[model samples]
Target: MFRRAFWFTAGAAAGVWATTKVNRQLKKLTPESLAAQAADKAIEAGHRLKDFALDVKSGMSQREDELNDALGLHQDPDLPANVTALPGPRRLRAIEQDQNDPTTQFSYNRNEDH
Candidate 1:
């Protein structure tokens, strides 16, 4: 029984050691693939930067052409139009005003009824 137990323990230890060794070997093969992937990413980034620069150049030229046209380097759209405003109190004068008509003040407070 003791011998059997010893063999089982030894087998488990060997398994553990072998697994660690295989993992280490696999790790050793990773750097070349990682370097290749990094190179691909760098190339992709370079192309994106080139496209962005071209888009910026195109936008700047369009704006410049529009400005030149507006400045009469080419034909412009319009210059001026007519405008008007509403007349208010500033255009008129306020005169004296009144409350109850003094002409019929005594006719208040009473009437011809019962």
Candidate 2:
């Protein structure tokens, strides 16, 4: 009968479609495919993080420049235009001192008098 043949054809088509779908899913679940997918995602995340860091850095520098301009920090009115300020002598001496000296050792004892 024509009705029986039509049903048989439909059933066969359904079976083929299901088999193809299952096969595609199995291919995606394989170890190599899974690893590739994970690697792709990690790379995408890294690129996004890198872009965020660069944006932050640029914004910080732009804000710093704006603040400096607002505060008039670009030039000192008291100092001569030709002369630039240098670090203080006391700070330089402190930085030049030996860091390994025993007298400079830090103490954590709580009972010691000030």
Candidate 3:
């Protein structure tokens, strides 16, 4: 009789524990809970991305300063912004089309029969 009572008590406690565990798991799988978890993860990723961008910007600034020092391109108060000579589009040199000009001897005429 004592063994039967002990077994019954044990079975009731196990049932309660299993129900609580399943309920907690189900609550976590609900849509609102899932959305909240996803939002938390996205916020964490955004923070990491912002930190990475700041690090890249700092490194680029340092490299730019080093390159300027190496190339002796110190900014001068007396120099005009246009005088910095930053690379830009340039006009192509005009090709001489005259057949008689020796410099134009290699000019190809697509219409001429070989």
Candidate 4:
């Protein structure tokens, strides 16, 4: 009788253990759990990508500074020695006027081609 009782207790314990293990696995495999896991991974990847972009930007700035120092471009704060001045607003307005003039030799009209 004692042996039978012992066997019964063992079987009940095994059944409970199996049921608990299966329930835990099922919970993990649910749609909500899967979506949450995917969301977490995507957020992690986004953070890593943002960090990489910031690092690249910092490296670019450092390299640009080093190049400026090597080329003696940092001597003037108002105007760099290596860079040329761009066309001002007056030059841009003159160029626009030229482009708009139909009598000009090099005038370009978008409507003319069509």
Candidate 1 residue-wise lDDT, 1-114, digit = tens: 999999999999999999999998887579897788789999999999999999999999899778876765643232112211222342211111113343432211112221
Per-residue lDDT of candidate 2, residues 1-114 (tens digit): 999999999999999999999999999999999999999999999999999999999999799779878877564563345433332555334435634454663322323322
Model 4, 31-87: lDDT tens digits are 999999999999999999999999999999899889877877554343334533344
- Model 4 CA lDDT for position 8: 100
Model 4 clashes, total count:
0
TM-score of each: 0.40, 0.65, 0.60, 0.59
Scanning candidate 4 in windows of ten residues, the lowest lDDT window is 105-114
Task: Between candidates 2 and 3, name the one with more favorable lDDT.
Answer: 2
Q: State each model's CA lDDT, in order.
A: 0.61, 0.72, 0.70, 0.75
Q: Which stretches of model 4 miss by more than 4 angstroms?
A: 1-7, 79-114
**For each candidate, C-alpha RMSD in Å?**
24.1, 10.5, 13.1, 9.4
Q: Which sequence of candidate numbers ranks them by lDDT, best first?
A: 4, 2, 3, 1
Overall local distance difference test of candidate 3: 0.70
In model 1, which regions exceed 4 Å deviation? 1-29, 74-114
How well does candidate 3 match the true structure in TM-score terms? Answer: 0.60
* Model 3 alpha-carbon miss at residue 70, Å: 1.5
Off by over 4 Å in 3: 78-114
